[model samples]
Target: MSTRKDSLKFTMTSRALKLLGQNLYARPWSAVSELVANGIDAGATTIYVSMTEDPATNTGTLEVLDNGSGMTEEDLEHYVSIGFDKRAVTGTLKSSRAPMGRKGIGKLAALYLSNEYYIHTKTAPKAGKQFDSSWHMQLDFMTDADKEPTLREINATTIPTIHLNEQFNKQDSGTLITIPEIELKGLGTQAFKSLASRLAIHFLKDVLPDLKIYFSHQKINEDPRFKEVEWHPAYGNFLLLSTTKSHTYVQDKIKRKVLIQSASRKDSTTVETSITPTPSFPLNDFENADIANHISTSHNSNTISGAYFPDPLSTQTYPYDLKGWLALHATIKTTLAQDNDSTFTKNQFFSPTQIRLYVRGKLALEDLRPYLNLTEQYANYLEGELQFDLLDEDDLPDIATTSRESFDTEDPRFTTLCILVRDWAQILINERSRIAQREKERLVKITANANNAYAKRLSQSIQKLSESKKRPEEVIQEVHLGLTDNDPLEPDAHTAAKEEYRIFISHSSSNKPIADIIYDMLIELGALPEEIFYSSKDTVSTDKTKQFKMLEKQIRETITDAATKICYITSKGFCSSVYCCFEGGAGWATRAVSDYELITTTYAHKPDWLDAGLQTTSIIDQTGTFTLNRETYMLFTQTINRLVEHLNVGRRIKQEPLINSILEDKIPSDYKLRTRKEKISDYYNPILADMITHAGKSDHSAEV
Candidate 1:
């Protein structure tokens, strides 16, 4: 049962072809990146990516145009030949730019993008000629698996298309590839801008200084405009590590053995000898250097913590150069908006936390975090970009896996690089911790001084108000006027009315679920459960007699005490319930002194019987399952921030859990809340502003 020699050859199936491209580039962004790389390899000085979306169909066409040394018909043939090594066949690329393509299979990214696409190209003229010919071709792959061609048939295929010589002058040489009818979403202005940033992070701009990339996206009728993408490395308290510098890790590992040199006469104690301790670039060296420099320079904030020029790492085994810097971000919460800077928005598409590794100026590994054991404290804040060109050295066997997403860990050079990187990362983490401790101490001193000044103003205001001997209303008004204009601690008073505060959560029994959520949220924001007066909480007394007494006592004390913050969760159940009305009326009376907050869960007009103060406060409607869009998220976070400030919870609040608990679908931010002045005037302004002495106001009569 032996097969014929002709039939013994390997066959290429259609499913295999499709799966090859799909597996190689699982993400659309990766396939697009490969296309850009091909353009760069062609010595293109400028690459333009233009995307046009059709909202009705939820699809788009992508066009990548590069002013590169375009391919000739012969070159086009080589491009179609999968796995053909152009470097081996034609020698080094003609341009000075390093070729970013290697396996020659990068062209498959085109197929991965779409089954049928158009390629418009024109070759550069010969030295003596003014112009060269231009060509156009359209390649269509069989989408149906049954119609696939054999390997020999695929090789025998010829290009079929139209000529576009009239579209350009002979001097213009470039390539434009168009991928039509691809599914796309989130191509709006901001998302497109983020795409530009994402593309910039994929390649090193310094290495390809002459290569300019512009990206743009537009709807069908809109005009296309492109914006250049630039890379801005976020470095904070960073150490610039260089392979050229002398350091211990690059030195050969020492093998030591102890040998007995002498024995004591009385106790027979043996004296041992060993090799001198292995040389190292210890953390102490950096600390000492930094201290000496900081002392001489008078604590300059701009100074770099440290810099080390190590001898080429992995020298004893496989010598390789490492060039790049590692830094600790100011905060580990990547989703936080840094002063409205869009760059820090916790980009799922391209996170800035990982160390990107580039080989021969092309991305070999998107992130090195997975390859290294970086479990040290504050390791999540570690970010860097490293270059290890040796990994892609022409002389070495290809160490990159088939997908080119990462390198072979089994390779000795890769393992050595990992060890060196892990050590350096640990160094960065330790150094960050040291700097953070110093910063924390400084902030503590500053906060203490501020708090002392604030407390002094408060004591003076209280004394003056007591001695005035005016009517209660008149004295309260005067104190409010004085503190509102002059108190530096006013903001803190506003943030948390008291260091120790209590919250009275009033809601109808029917709205218990919403009340429970609010209760847990308040607890999460730093309010102790015991200090929060939620009637339904299990800890509260359930006996009818004790419950009335407790509620009556809470209402009586809260009306007169500034330490109690009242939150009224109003709904249909609340408006109709007699007990809810009692709580609301009690909370209303406290408006003159107590800090009261209102939340409405219905769209209907609030009852006119509600206190005017609660009516003026911003209304937060729970129209759905408390989902947060960008705008709603902002509103919710701002609300939580205010609540925390008023309570003076000692811990910083994290919005992640709250934000993650709800759906984050994009929604219009048209839902507006009242301005701070309008919302706070009725309660926060009159009571809080005058409770402390303001620093700069000579006239207490000024309206806050």
Candidate 2:
């Protein structure tokens, strides 16, 4: 032990072999796609994937047959050799098709999918050779606790011949891989269709347009049916943003015609069921053109090229170029019943809504969201496919992880791509925010108009009721009429005791019903009509300039007067109105010069600005029903008492009677009131309220 040997030998146990076989892939589709990539690397033009399910055993058989340049005897040995790099043998793929597979361990995907599988293969016929031989082999990863098993121990047997399909026999060579006991639970038609769609995405359509994939499914005792899963990219009402403005997708007011293909198999005869040209909207006609325009302007020129220092200490730099289209989806939901396409449909298990990155036509990263670590507002609505083949170029160092799911994020090449994607995502988010703001403003304007109409009706109803000496019995059926506004003693007949303090009613025109209730309650409690500045009656001029002048003069005089009491009626409508905001700002200024007693309609309708520091009496809730409880009634009484003490005025009517009348009779009889049990402790924070009330009093005294 004192002197180590010149070189130490490394060995892998049987348990390590099993671990590599079983835990190589994270998803079922990913493992399956690896097999597909192998076929593509072999220069396959047509591939067929067939799956059979047995519901009883929760297992099935899966077979992948491809008319590709099949493997030779030497190639078979290389496949079983774990961790063998095929790149060392062949620099590039046949026909210059970019090889999607490098690490020869793609065979682990088949091992992970099934306990045992069979592979039958034959190479392309020689120039003069008439009879060609096919090979058949069975393999499994057997783990033993005591002994380690090596891949070299596996054996293969020679067969007379193997036929791929009706078109390809001994003369034409291909490969057929069959997994007899694949442990796949609930494998059916839908699962196969989903796999086909995902494979199309894994191997993009643009890169492999010549490749056609067909899927067939079978149950325990049923005939197998096949469907040609066409490669279709799903996008509806989308705008294409690229590194170049001259791209076809970026053209304005152009309709794109895409071929919609479907295939059905009837007894080995494949029929093209439908082939239609479905037109899609262009940039100018896009529903979300404003957002698309911003994305376009953000990219003045369309090229994304950067140089990165691969070695931090070295002066040499390597240049990389990125090509892809980033598309923003206006709506993920299907707009029409006819628009329901399987590739476009999203389910709990699968969703096409992801930003996929491809390296040499093989999916390197499933989604860029995880790589970028984005939590943007509309991050989910963005989907794209980017290609950065330089990362996989032969001259560059192999940077892809073992699983091939992602690259080394610390790499300068990947980091440069991340920065560009993040910038594009930010542009989409910024535009979405702008569109949201415009929609909010439009909704606010519509609400203001509706509220103004309602306020006018409420004003008319009050005027008509005041014109007649209607008794309580006469107006018992009317839910709007209450004792405060329609008591035996009329408001004009019984004079309110003169008081120095004035009440300012701040509310939106739509909230007049609640505001009128507060106004009548104040009048019944001895606040004179002159001492209250309610814009409804105070600003009665029809001319716009006169009405503005009347509102301005009344608000300035009442709010500046030291001893003015304020009643604010806050609601959604109130917050939307510019006039109400101005009034609220003026009322808030009065707290420094006057000991203002503030009362709000309800806690739910309380504006966010007033939530932190302001102290007010919040009585009713949003539904026009009273928050009837001991805590609320006590808070209301205390606020009114403070106002009465400060103003030195006599109560024309008791506070309890007016509050009870408003709670019991002002709202509709069906609007039942309940005691809110939860958060009742928060309803009455009298210590905090008293502090704020006294703070304003000290400010008033100092001002005087």
Candidate 2: stretches off by over 4 Å: 1-15, 90-92, 130-171, 186-190, 237-247, 250-300, 312-317, 332-343, 453-704
| Per-candidate clashes, comma-separated | 17, 2
Error of 2 at 475 (Å): 14
Among all windows of 10 consecutive residues in model 1, the one with the lowest summed lDDT is: 260-269
Go through the candidates in order and give the C-alpha RMSD of each one to the true structure: 19.9, 24.0
Tell me the RMSD of model 2 versus the true structure: 24.0
lDDT per residue for candidate 2 within 327-440, as digits (tens), equals: 554435543211423336666556666888988777888888777667865677677778877677666688888788878876556665666677766666566556546545
Q: What is the C-alpha lDDT of each candidate?
A: 0.55, 0.56
Per-residue C-alpha lDDT of model 1 across residues 452-504, encoded as one tens digit per residue = 43355356555666554546555444334222322223455433122224567
